[model samples]
Target: MSDRIDKSLTRKKLDKTLKPHWVWAIALGSSIGWASFVMPATWMGEAGPLGVILGLTLGALLMIVISISYGVLIRNYPVSGGEFAYAFLGLSRLHAYISGWFLTLGYICIVALNATAFSLMLKFIFPNFIEQVKVYEIAGWEVYLTEILLATILIGIFTVLNIRGTTISGRMQFIFVAILIVGVLTITIGMTSSAETSFSNLTPLFTPEISALAAILTIVAIAPFAYVGFDNVPQAAEEFKFSSKKALTLIVLAILFAAAIYSLMILATGVAAPWQEISQANHAWGTGFVVQEVLGTGGLIVLATALTMGIFTGLNGFLISSSRVLFAMSRGKVLPKAFSNLHSRYNTPYFALIFAAVIAIIAPWFGREVLGWVVDMSSVGVSIAFFYTTYTAYKLLKWSEQDEGYNPELHIVSPGKKVVTLLGMIASVSFLVLLLYPESPAALGMESIVALLVWIAIGAIFYMIRRKELAKYTREELAYLILGKDQFKLKKEEE
Candidate 1:
């Protein structure tokens, strides 16, 4: 083995202040957003309570397997950019850019997705106030000036809070997550304790029209989108005060906790009233409708409060995550270096935060359905990142085993880790198949497919433009910037 020094490049680092609990809060909070509260109708309609619960449980298991791959990568290379950095180290620069591009799509679009949900929640609580001043319509969904203003204001607030610093944002995330948990428990307990509820209301475990496997697969296919937050941990790895090994436990715990909350919300919906009726009733907010039925207007107020917090947490978490991804990519010279600029006093990625917020603020103008198409497309991007990380782990493990000169001191690969990485890759491919396969129940709509194509085209154009700028640097110089000075010494032969 040979090691060489690359002295020309200097790495920029984020502030390290995230505690273990705060990291957990970030992952859990980001995963459980307005979708849990506002949109159970589609899943509940396709799969009854039992099917949904089973599906989510299985999904969590798959995520845990994938988490093992993430943990292995983090243990070996604890850096910012998560999958982007991993792909570059274990795969190639081209793979890294692809991973970063898709990961950016997933993280940044979610910021807009959550912000748009805020306007929808306002419309639910104060229809007269929020629905006024109709601006325009896209795909039959009305765009209101009030809604746009509300979303923009939210995006702006979170952008400023994140730019202030991660310490401030992490603490705020912890508190908001606590409130969210309390509110969720309150709603679930109230709905379950109501005299009108009967567990039998969840009967016919699967939707009669669909096969049981399909019912469960429908939810399983969206697991990448649903369980995205845990990966955010890797994005902030450079700033982790604690050891990266500890993050694996936090990730698994967060995934389990999120899964429990999701199942409880679905259970609350089913038991409060006949799930079939709630599904068929087709209320804009099915969960909200049931809450009002069980606990009256007071319950609606509590649920709305919880949902608002969810939206807030989602906005804050994704802003932190997306900005960090941008900063990492910029540091690697894959994106414009301007994105890596930091705030003078606070030391946050101000340019990236502002850029992410600006993109999100513009989303509400196009209306909710248009945003939905983007989100649907973004899920594919999320799954792509997952696959890249898992595949990277698989490559590293196999390389370690096959290389006669492999250094055990460098990385100790436990006997069964190779198997786990293989399983993780299989699970990731399954998620992709479910989303992209036309015959699959969870396949993307035509609009979402078009959105996916557009995003890929945009990435291709940007990559071509960036490659010319990057031609000035040798491969070693590029590795020093992306993997840092210490890691660049350990770089493998270029593929």
Candidate 2:
């Protein structure tokens, strides 16, 4: 058994080739997606242009706090597990497992969400070609065979790409992110230059259907889904070819970039199309419709191509980040060791990537409406992880101050850092509670709640089974047991 574990540790190490730009690309690609293209209209429908701006701005500010907390923690403990590692170091083994479990679930749901989003985009672009053949129904939503097949095909392709290696995935992210930026620029130029569009179109920017506070809270609840990918940088900390400070800076930049794009999207959509007309249109393809209005058929074609690329980057980024979480759990003995297996040639967590792909493929069979549920549920999971991470950051900072050997140069501890960390934790908790609020726009359906419960139950059962295997060893023994001497030595040398 010892021999087997040792061999696994040495054979399954992650490759460290990602530079600062690649890390930034992954974070951006993961956050900005087809949803970003259309969510402006949806936000406008809920709260008007002014409301959308306020909500996104507040949400972005909160996300910046969360991102800074993440940066501080990653700087102190730069590892692959991300929140999981922080929780383990500051809290306990059990807390670490739970944090990792929540993050992994969130990442998997994001992958599934993007796969469904991709299929929906295809239907919007080729409404005639992708005919809907209703297979069955779930939760009052009709399931279509064509959509299911399309999503599965996309999942399969990206799964193969991820299993090939992070280098391929990172390069793909860079290319697609470049295209997405160009698309955003084109839309902005088209909207501003169009004679038909006017500032008057954005009248009544503030609507009174909902209170400003409620509107902002609604956006905050959904913000986790929008800004989900920035934390992916820390999840691949070991794979970065830069200092922790640089990696942290890149994560912050990614968040700001995503925020700017989202805000601009809302502004452009509001100015180009009347709020009432946009509200009445098919909300899923609202952005594409706006492009059609501003730039005609040629613009629509270009946007579709760019949006397709964005979806691919999103799928790839989530896959890479999620697999690393699974790999970390397996390495820590919280999950089955098989999940830690890497591709011999590519040095990627192939088994974990395949498992995530299976989930993504299965998600579309439930229909596109369920995508909302998945996104909402994922927000809850992400919030839980964020809360723990922030809490851990606070605890670690306090602990470092009390330690005699603590060096400010090696650790990130400041007098006001605790306050920011506490605010991050509070904000995360607020988002989680807001998501469950019945009247909130981002409220989770009963089905999503049940789905979340089932996932948690599965994690609980897995923990129990793994606990028995780990009980015979002490904490230090278990740590060393999973990470063999050779790998430990390698890590020490690298540090």
Candidate 3:
């Protein structure tokens, strides 16, 4: 394997987004598993305050393992494709197909959920405009026209930002995430005095019921989503100068910052309203829920405005991350070359991004709790990706070149790394096993294999038969493929 070379112009411009420290900070912070706040965390905590706490603790523990191991992989085998890129290096083309398919589907689900949230916010800010959907209902249509319109607009914005390239997209992420953290803190602190929190509720004592474990696993499992957005951060690696080191640091810091922020918000919100009441009264959170809960009318307006912008930013995150995954797949010839194309001017993958937006625009009409369903599948994608990477890591440790070739800066063989990666894989596989059970699958396996398979098939057919026409995006992805090329070989280099 070759060292990562600065052979591409597109990558160089992307480096301008953030230098080393900013790269690590932005990437790490950007991936903060945010949907946990938007979806299950609030409801779970509300439904069973103790239950959610236990679950969050358990899930966070597992995620810590998963995340650290993921970081190791990123540090060792940095690349533009998130999980898919890693898999392609270690696993067979078949597993590569599997990983990319799941990630693309997972990202689509992310976009769908983000777009859905954006549309819902639009309805809140302009109820009359959304109320126009009633007119569509009268026409015997099952879909909500206004919701679709609003969603399309959000998707359009994401596609446009993504077309502008990684630097712009990543900075956009930093801006939104920054505001989102501040807004959440302001609301949580202003509303719930930290001293008011009941210490007993802070640590729930669960009975001997399995519900405790399952529920906790579900909650903790979600923290991975908070970190999942980092998947896109690496997609822009080609744009970084010292991507291997800088990108890894950025991804890790982002996770830590986000985790801290979430803990504070949960603490504040938990104090403001009892878990059960918040769960029962306000299952869905947005501008209305946050404001009404925190500051009444004033809070409502403030939260509404912040939420509107935050969710729109989330949509942008989805657009850039998901499309990048597809773009990476396209470059590998697993997908159509069109997906790999760069806008000669903006230096973004225009067609793949537009493709992502179109699907995101259409997802809301499914009216099926877009986030709820997507979260389950996204969990699957996360786990599957983790599983492959960890297994590859195990292989890396056992078989990488040894006999004096070593990376003292890297720590793949340390007991801590080993234990965590193993446990992370266990946690991921456990969630997957739980999904096989019909009763719990919906809660943890919302990602659609059918959907994934269809997308992969489409991508493959286009690549094999239709790739000749689309211009290819180029430049060497050396370090990009090295980390996952089998751990044993890395050991050999260590020698």
By lDDT, the best candidate is: 1
lDDT of 1: 0.85
Candidate with best TM-score:
1
TM-score of every prediction relative to native: 0.96, 0.90, 0.77
- As a TM-score, model 2 comes out at 0.90
Worst 10 residues of 3 by lDDT: 486-495
Error of 1 at 351 (Å): 0.1
What is every candidate's alpha-carbon RMSD to the true fold?
Answer: 2.0, 4.3, 6.0
RMSD of 3: 6.0
For model 3, residues 1-495, the per-residue Cα lDDT tens digits are 334433442321122343454354444443543353454335344334455555545555565566665666666665557677666545554465577777776777767776666656556556677756443332233447777777777678767866876666656666666666677777766666544445344344332234665555545545556556655565555556565655545655565665565555555555554455554565446325644655677666655555655565556666666776777776665676688787888767788888888877666676645345555555666668778776665444422336244454443456556676677678778766655455651244324544434555665775456334322311234223222231223321110
Assess each prediction's global lDDT (C-alpha) against the native.
Answer: 0.85, 0.77, 0.57
* Candidate 1 colliding pairs: none
Q: Is candidate 1 or candidate 3 better by lDDT?
A: 1
